[model samples]
Target: MDTSSIVILDFGSQYTQLIARRIREQNVFSVVLPCTAKIDEIQAQNPLAIILSGGPCSVYDADAPPADPEVLNLGLPVLGICYGLQFITHHLGGKVSPAPRREYGHAEVELIDRANPLFSEIPANIHVWMSHGDEALELPPGFHLTAKTANAVAGIANPERRIWAVQFHPEVHHTKQGSALLRNFLFSIVGAKPDWTPGHFIQSTVTAIRKKVGSGHAICALSGGVDSSVAAVLVNQAIGGQLTCVFVNNGVLRRDEFQKVQRNMRDNLGLNLVAVDASERFLAKLAGVTDPETKRKIIGNEFIAVFDDEAHRIAKQTGGVDWLVQGTLYPDVIESSSVKGPSQTIKSHHNVGGLPETMKLKLIEPLRDLFKDEVRRIGRDLHMPDDILQRQPFPGPGLAVRILGEVTPERVALLQEADDIVVAEIKAAGLYQQIWQSFAVLLPVKSVGVMGDQRTYAYTCAIRAVHSEDGMTADWVPLPYEVLKTISSRIVNEVRGINRVVYDITSKPPGTIEWE
Candidate 1:
């Protein structure tokens, strides 16, 4: 283990990624691996410190995930979290059992050993975020209690062996001084340096990509969103003419998206972009599909088919296209599947899981381990345009998911107009950058409305706006009345075949960001 890196072992906790994110916020590099990772795998990063993430399983469960016991003897500084604390206790000849009063939310932990470097500059009693059912009942040999809450052992340490642990999560904002606690561990205890920056990442990644793709041809599936656009550029920088970017019009994109993206990527970014028009074919496939999942499957399947045809065509021209570059970010990986046994995934990412299983090309995902914010930093450092860098996330199925029912050429055009107006008003009001997603959904149900003294029935338009850190969870944005009025008035007054407008007021738990 070196002094520049940190390795976080995932024990199936959803917060494992958050732990990695928190450490990276300090400009130090950290990587996440499953708890089942071998000792040599952990040593591969030459990490300066190791973090054991909290998980859902009890320490005594039959299927409880296990860390290599050999990891404890590596002589590296170790910090164990909730389930982590229990794991260390169970492994080191200590007792771990169900807590009489399980802590699942906010609690207070009183620091008893104020002189301990782990608690240095922290308050005597601090509020922390807790989520666990088990607790350490007895300290392991050579371990000493450093802090305690009302009902459980809150903190423990063995400075001689350089191991520390806490029962509460220090990566969440609810913990108040959580950032400070993590910083203390990163700098004061582990003696790590702040050397991982945007320039550092780009330089290292380019070199790595170049070496990996030596004298090979690659093609990028560019969606023109922040993720794919950045990924395309990074790959282009690695192997200039050996890369081809394929942008397909799937018949459901936003207004002027095809043209705008082509111009920006080819003219502005200097990418070898190949624009494909398969609108008629995509629209034909989605003619009468209404079920949300069915629509996603059809679109995803059709997209892969089109991309496969394109890859083959390009391969014949360039001798070969051996690699497929995707913008698969960390959250996409987490949401698509389990980090380990204890982590629960909401749904398979349509962007990732929907890919056909028979594709033969190898994948080159440079941004696989990065967060969305970190990708934006790299984009800015690479001198990518603000329009591409600041654009909100667009779904893989495009307007097929936004439109609630059957997709057709006419419906797509109408929805595009309404969606365009909603976006324009949001951007005009200077809320585009502030809002996570603001778009219009065309509904199948229609209502009667008086238009210039003539009664008419038309499709209803629903406006959706949400704010989110990542697409995993979101809250509906409460747009101002004036902005809503402008959007509704414009959609009804200017765009024909639309009578009424509505706003979605539900959050992520009860309702997803998209209506479908």
Candidate 2:
């Protein structure tokens, strides 16, 4: 289906994925490419319009990133945001300078031209979220300022060339009519139609997978989480009996997760699932690895090794296995493959940075373009059970990352017990679905406490619960004090190792959902 889509040039903005999500919500398809993407790559998507994402860089920097000069001359409608706005201005004969005062929070924007299509139905005075250190001090040739704040230009437009730019982030929830603004740009200006949906995605993906892996067997790393589960099932739908799913038990899974997931895959989903107990092997390799990155690399390499061994065995039994399917989401791709964006590598995802160069099988990532919620929608459309669809987001590296220090049996057991209690309590409080990701991280530090009137030193556990639309950005869940009290009390009393419990109050900007 030749769908009308938008091409989002990623400048490593934290909100770049949010912009794509907003466009998809309008039932229009969108894809994100790196800022350094060649002009041909941008044109290959046949985008109806191009959107330049906001980033954490100033256009006037010594090594400032710039889009392809050819993109400006493509004659396609371009919308620049934040750093993107500055880039468009500075590159096209306009002046950009550092703001005297950086705007970092909510600010009111007044529409100077009420007739502008981008601000079609928007009110005169509206609030927007701003995060920038530089501003487009002067408009480019043929550009008119359409909106302004008290101290800076909020928006500029060149109606003749169909170029638009905004200083504030319209994709974030802090903006009242952000979606409306995007809709105006997508529909009113670019003439795009809302035609994308989960059902359409499922049908198209099935066909694509079938065409990609024809007559060849494929192996999927099934963690039984929503992302992997959906990927496994979708591929199974495409090539039945040709897909062998390897579920590796890395000694860091939640309590009874392996057994339950095994049963579900075998009976519920009817996948060709193989459960590999490589826990001891993984633990032995990670014996004294204290560094988080090292632990991740060990786990990642071990996972691939196990998968390779299993694949060889399967190939011996069958003919051969040529592909490895993963449930890698867009955030993982964006964070891992950030080429020109200022977005820093927060943490290495196992499925991403952990893969070995020597691995023989090619990767098939169906959900690479989708977010967490979008994957859930596709799972629902496939009639997956609520339990599978609502499973909490688990890292591919498993509990190895959850345990702050060394990945060992003792630490894994302690973290698993504490994590199990956290989940059980959250489910008991009827807040499981309301929260995005809730897990327990076993801190490396130990504290002294009196247990049964005897002084003892034991591990301390940190509980993290966050509210997020997608895992791209999150805020700590403002759990009720009573809920917090219950969780803390339960973890300390029920879990044997932990002496104390602490809750993470940091948001995604300063902290990630996972401690590692």
Query: Backbone collision count in every prediction?
Result: 1, 0
lDDT of 2 at 384: 85
Number of the top-ranking candidate, with TM-score as the measure = 1
Q: What is the alpha-carbon lDDT for the whole of candidate 2?
A: 0.87
Q: Write the per-residue lDDT of candidate 2 for residues 1-516, one digit (tens) a residue.
A: 355579998887878888988999998999888889898878888889999988877787776666675676678899998988888898888999999888998999998989899999899999999999898888999999999899999999898888999999999999998999999999999998887899889989999999999999898888889999999999999998999998999888898998999999989889999999988999999998989889888888888788778878998887887888988888777766565545556787677334455656788999998888899999999888889999878887889888887888988988888888889889999999999899999998999988789887989898899998767679998988988898889888888889999888999977778888
- lDDT minimum window of 10 residues, candidate 2: 351-360
Model 2, position 120: C-alpha lDDT score:
92
C-alpha lDDT values of all predictions: 0.89, 0.87
RMSD of 2: 3.2
Task: Give candidate 1's error at residue 424 in angstroms.
Answer: 0.7
